[model samples]
Target: MSDFLQQVVIGVQLGSIYALIALGYTMVYGVLRLINFAHGDVFMVGAFVGFYAARALKLEEQPTLAGALITLLPVLLLAMVACAVLGLVIERLAYRPLRRAPRLTALITAIGVSLFLENAGQLLFGADPKFFPSVTPQGAGATLNLGGATISKDQLVLVVAAALLMAVLWYIVQRTRIGRAMRAVSHDADAAALMGINTDTVIAFTFGLGAALAGAGGMLFAALTYAKILPLMGIAIGLKAFVAAVVGGIGSIPGAMLGGLLMGLSESFVRGSGFSRWTEAVAFVLLIGVLLLRPAGLLGRFAPEKV
Candidate 1:
């Protein structure tokens, strides 16, 4: 029972990470119906940005609580801003011209962008993995007991942060003018444009907003146990997040979050069962199962077009 509880806690932590990235995937797809495969690369860039931000701020390798927090907030904001710019650039140069082109063309361009970012990242950041700076102060290995289970301070912080970010995103989508514009564009781009909403600008903003979230995900992911950050780190993580979005219903924000948590639980359960080798494959298997059971995902609703 204790083991089960522990796994559940870990699952939530992983879910938080996946949910953050999946939100980006769902947002971009909702607006453009484009996968933006390069999104994962933007996440990689975010991690790198966080690293440089830390170094630039001269953060100590081992920091006090106050110092760690002072460094954390600025680095996170910096990473988000950097990735937002990168996202805008990708939209303007690579995707904007092809917006009216065939979906196939746009799809291929997205893949091309993904490849370019990966290779370019390797060239710019080098191929070797770098240790992410710890955001927790030294001697901060605190744990909280839940039933018979223990949850680390890091896990608690991540879960809270993810929840806060998700809440803010929800508010933006539900209450803000830009979010209303986004929805209007998503429902009918032509109609929205005719109604005087700047469809093009909205689409670009959607991309930037999603990319910024992905950046936050990158920073949090790296901070987890001080994970290694590599140029290709986003590939697997991005894939999982994509799966989460699909499982939750690609265009539904809430669906993306639910799907992430579900996948995280599944992976954790599989790992606990001693089939750790199947951890990665388990997510895809769950995706296949979900598709077979509900093509539209858990919360997804779809109506077939009349022929």
Candidate 2:
């Protein structure tokens, strides 16, 4: 029972990071029907931004609670802002021009953008892995015992922070005026534009918002889970998050969250079962299973396309 609980905690922690990234995938697909393959690279950029910001602020030198908060807040905000701007630039330059073009054109351009970011990141940040500064004062060994299971402070902080961000996102999507416009655009771009909503603005905003979430996820993953950052790091993580989005029924916010949790739990349990070698393959297996069983995903509804 304790082992089960322990795995559950670990799963939730991992799932939170996946959820953040998956949200971006779902949102972009919803609004533009274009999968921004470079999104994961955007996530990588966020981690690097956070890494540099932490170093610039000398965050690692101060381990106190107050110091950690100071380091965390600014670094997170900066990463999100930088990624958001990058997302806008990508949209305006790479995607907007091809908006009316064939879907395959936009997709290939997305892949091209992804490759460009990866190579550019390698050039600018170096291909070497960099150590991420810890925001919490607690040492890595520090953990609390609950019901015979141990949970790290970092994991607790990460879960809470992720929940807060998700809540904020839910509020923005469900209550804000711009959010309504986004939904309108997603439903029917031509109709939304005819109804006086600027589809282009909504599309750009969706990209920026999704990229900001991915940025936050990147920072959290680096600071809390991985403790390292590299130019190529986003590749695997991004792929897994993409799987999560697909499994959760791409374009559905709640489905993305559920899918992320499921993917994390599956990976965690597989590792705990002494099949750690199979952990990497678990995502693809689950994705394949979901695709076979429910083509629209666990929470996604299938819609017939108009001929």
Candidate 3:
């Protein structure tokens, strides 16, 4: 039981990161009905942003709780903002002109953009993996015991931060005017435009918002789970998160969260059982199983065309 609990704890921690990234995927899919396959590259950019931000602030030198907070908050915000702009640029330059083109054209463009970002990252940051600087305070990373499970400080912080971000996102979607506009546009872009909502602006905002979340996820993943950052690292993680979004039902907010948690738990359990090599394979298997059982996804409902 204790062993199982430990895996659960680890699963939840991993799930938080996956959930954060998956939200971006579902949101973009909801608004645009297009998968921003380049999103993973945006996440990679966020990690780099966080890396430089932390280094510039000298967080590595001033390792204290207060200092860590000072460094962490600013780094996170900057990374989000940077990625948000990148998202806008991607939409405007790579995707906008092609909106009227064939769906295959846009999909190809997305792949092109993704490749550009990855190659650019490699050119700028090099192909060698870089070690992320530690922001933890002096002797601060101890594990805490909870219900017969050990929770690391990193895991606890990541989980809490993810929860907070998700809460803020929920509020935005549920209560804000822009949120309503987003929903309206997602439902029917032409109708939303007729209703005086700027579909373009709403779509752009959705991209920015999703990108920001992905940025934060990138930073968290680097700081907590994986410190090694390479230009292509996002590929694997992004694929998994994409699978999570699909599993939860693409375009369904709650489904994305549920799918992320399930994916993480299954992977963690598999790893715990010493099947670490098959970890990546599990996501695809689950996706196939879900598709066979419920083609729409675990939470997705099929909507017939009104035409």
Candidate 4:
């Protein structure tokens, strides 16, 4: 039972990160109906940004609670802002011109952009992996044992922070004016434009918003879970998040969250079962199973295309 509980905690922690990244995928798809393949690389960029920010701030040198708080907050904000700007730039320069082109054209361009970012990351940050500095204060909150399962303060912080971000996102989507315009554009860009909504602006905002979430996920993953940073790190994680989005219903925010949790739990249980080698493959297996059983995903609605 303790073992089971431990896996659950670990699963939820991992799920939270996946959920953050998956939200980006779902949001962009919701508005543009286009998958931004470079999103994971954007996540990678966020992690790097956080890494540099932490170093510049000399966070590792300060081991006090106040120092940790200062380090964590600033690093997160900096990563998010930088990624958001990158997202806007990508939308303006790479995707906007292809908006009216065939879907295939946009998709290919997305792939091209992904490759460009990956190579650019290598050129700029080098192909070697860098260690991410710790932002959690020493001995802060210690490790708590819950029902024979132990969890660190960092993990707790990661989960709570993710939840807060998700809540903010939900509010923006359900209650804000920009969110309404986003929804309108998603439903029908032409109609939204006719209704006097700025479709282009909404679309760009969607990209920026999604990218910002991905950035947060990147920072959290680096600071809390894995401390290794690399240029190509986003490739695998991005694919998994993309799988989560597909499994949750590509354009549904709630679906993306559910899918991310499910993916994380599934992977955790697989590792716990002593099949760590299969951990990476499990995401795709779950995706295939979901598609076979429910093509629209666990929470997604299927809409028939007009011929």
Clashing pairs in 4: none
Q: Report how far residue 4 has shifted in candidate 3, in Å.
A: 1.0
Worst 10 residues of 3 by lDDT: 61-70
**How far is 274's C-alpha from truth in model 2 (Å)?**
1.4
Off by over 4 Å in 1: 61-67, 303-307
Cα shift from native, residue 139, model 2 (Å)? 3.4
**Residue-wise C-alpha lDDT for candidate 4, range 164-261, written one tens digit per residue:** 99999999988999999988887877889999998889999999999999999999898877568999999988998899999999999999999999
lDDT of 3 by residue, 1-307 (tens): 8889999999998898888889998998888888889988888999988887777776673455556666688889999999999999999999889877977898889899999999999999999997667776535445778788888777888898999999999999989999999999888888999999998899899999999999999888777664698899889888888999999999888888999898899999999999999998887899999999988889987767546
Writing each residue's lDDT as its tens digit, candidate 2 over 1-307 gives 9999999999999999889999999999999988889999999999999899888887763556556666688889999999999999999999999989999999999999999999999999998999886667766555889998999877888888889989999999999999999988888788899999989999999999999999999988888775679998889888888999999999999999999999899989999999999997888989999999999999987867644
Q: What TM-score does candidate 1 get on C-alpha atoms?
A: 0.95
lDDT tens digits, residues 1-307, model 1?
9999999999999998889899999999888888989988888999999887787776664445445656688888889999999999999999999988988899899999999999999999999998776667545455678998988777887888889989999998999999999988877788899999999999999999999999998987776558899999989888899999999998889999999999889888999899999998888989999999999888877846323
Report clash pairs, candidate 1.
none
Counting clashing residue pairs in each candidate, in order, gives 0, 0, 0, 0
Candidate 4: lDDT over CA atoms?
0.90
In model 3, the Cα lDDT at residue 287 comes to: 95
Candidate 3 runs further than 4 Å off = 61-67, 138-141
Error of 3 at 106 (Å): 0.9
